[model samples]
Target: MKANVWHGKNKLQVDNVPDPTILNPRDAILKITSTAICGSDLHLLDGYVPTMEKGDILGHEFMGEVVELGSAVTNLKIGDRVVVPFTISCGHCLSCEEKLYSLCENSNPNAWMAEKMWGHSPAGIFGYSHLTGGYAGGQAEYVRVPYADVGCFKVPNDMSDDQVLFLSDILPTGWMAAENCSIEPGDVVAIWGCGPVGLFAIQSAFVQGAERVIAIDRFPERLRMAKKLRAETLNYEEVSVLEALKQLTGGRGPDACIDAVGMEAHGVGMVGAYDTIKQAVRMESDRPIALREAMMACRNGGTVSVPGVYGGLIDKVPFGSVMNRSLTIKTGQTHVQRYMQPLLERIQKGEIDTTCIITHHLPLDEAPHGYDLFKNKQDECIKVVLKP
Candidate 1:
């Protein structure tokens, strides 16, 4: 089987790898039909996330036909079309029982690796690094999905793969980010970054009853997409973001601020330069420019919602500002299983269209090109889906 394999920093290749077979009684083999390159994947490609071995498979958002099912998996059958959530969960665990599937204790085989880094471990994610779980991703022609009864969501026969595919990641991530904001009707929400996650965050904010959403980014194409959803956009390069957001909100600041741009955020003055230098030297693991800006621009006693991916240590976080203002912060890897069925119902009801962000579709073999295009923001690429 041909799949996207990670080599090292800024390197990915399509290689012929052995096909996956059922390794657990709860596992199901998926003949992958559609998969997406997520923003988090770019962190791995750029050497931001640690413990990624050479030739590791590199994808997580995917959907396909169930080709074979293990004896213990009774919820699905062969030939059933299904979308697999990125987070691997055992439904019987304490975390899963609370609907926090992303923190399921039983799934991360490499939990100790993560514990050394963050003092705790998260759920195993498909195609993420060894720190999360050394599990192979779904960027291949096929993949083995563990805990199938709890993680796989079957889609309706009439929907196209494009319409349902993002349920595996970004769509739910965006929705969760918005839901964390706890928006009251007519509230003003501000979001940083206009990438796929940010775009969906904008849509989800409106869906959750936010009266106005302000989107911030430097890319015209991304800002244009946000505008199409009626979000007022700001090109961070054109104005002082803090002041601009202040003025836009009548000097009160936005009610809630969403940082959808993760560790690779481009910063402006000396602070950004410091982050770049430290990141290059391995002194810091993430860039927190958007997070800092969001905290600085959020209304006092308001919420700060983070859907961005951050792997490790950050410096100069404004804890003073947070304490002084009494701001509430909520962030996490999305519990995709919790949102999968409801968001799918939204898609089925035509309440949301997830395919609006797709800008490129290529074969599974062209994954290298897809990664380059997505990382470089070339050719106006917002999202890329590979057909295997």
Candidate 2:
């Protein structure tokens, strides 16, 4: 099998690796058909996560055909097409029953990590680091499916992989981000980072009845996408984000704000991993730059949702700036399974089309190229899907 590995800082390479085999009773094997590169992958590429090794497999979002199943796996059978959630979860956990799948006890059960929250704390993720349950990634010809019954969601035979690929991460992330906002009809939402997550956050906000969504990012291409969605796009390079945010909401900041840009923010120039994030806090710059801005831009008594990943300790939080505002802050990794089925139904009904975010489709071996394009934001590349 071939895969893209993160050799070091700003480096990626395609390499041949061993194929995966069924390892657990709940596991399944998938002949990967489509997989996506996400903003999260960039974090690993830049060494933001500690456990990513020299040859970590590098994809998470994917929809593929099941090739085999473990003895205990019953929900999914061979030949079924499914969209896999980036988070590994067990449906029988307390959290899973409550629909808080991200905190599923069987997977993580009590673990704070995404994989464990879903199922088998030992059930590693596809392409994340060892610390993240180091399950092999799907950025290859074949991937081993762990906790099959609790992980992959069976897609309708009529649906296209491209249309539902994001269900694995970003689309549901957007829905989770929106849910964090607690927005009411006619509410205003401001999203930082126009990347796919933020873009979906914008659309999802609209779907959730946000009357206006203001998108913030430095990229012209992303801003253009925001414009296409009728979201008011603001280039952070052009104006003071705080001032602009204030202006957009008629002197009141947006009712809700979401930070889709996580640890690898725009300004710090890929400042290493979660452990090194504390260094960012000491600087004058915002730790989670987007998160802080979103908090600062949130209306008094409103909410600020951070679907973006944030780690490391902070020295400065701009809390003083947002103080006296009685703001509510909501954040965490997306409870992907919670939204998967509902969003899948929406996709089946044509209420949302997330495929527009996918710009490059390449063979599994081209994973490095896809990363370069996505990381550099070049050729207007937003999402890249790898076919194995």
lDDT of 2 by residue, 1-388 (tens): 7767678757888888888898889998898889899888887777656556777777888888999899998777789998898877767767677777665555532233433222234323567776556667888778887778878888887778898889999999988898888889989999888899998898889988899999988889899998998899888888889998888778988999888887666333322443343343222343336766777778889988888775344334778766688888887667787788999888777777788888899987778888889999999998898887
Candidate 1 residue-wise lDDT, 1-388, digit = tens: 9999999878899999999999989999999999999999988887777578898999999999999999999989999999999999999999999999999999999897777666788899999977778889999999999999888899999999999999999999999999999999989999999999999999999999999999999989999999998999999888889999999999999999999997777322111122233332233333338998999999999999999987765556788999999999999999998898899888888777798999999999999999999999999999999998
Candidate 1, residue 121: CA error in Å?
0.8
Clashes of 2: 16
Q: If scored against the real structure, what TM-score would every candidate get?
A: 0.95, 0.90
> Which pairs of residues collide in candidate 1?
none
Superposing all C-alpha atoms, what RMSD in Å does each candidate have to the true structure?
Answer: 3.6, 3.6
Which ten residues in a row are the worst by lDDT in model 1? 266-275
Instruction: Indicate the TM-score of model 2.
Output: 0.90
The per-model lDDT (C-alpha) reads: 0.90, 0.78
lDDT of 1 at 221: 96
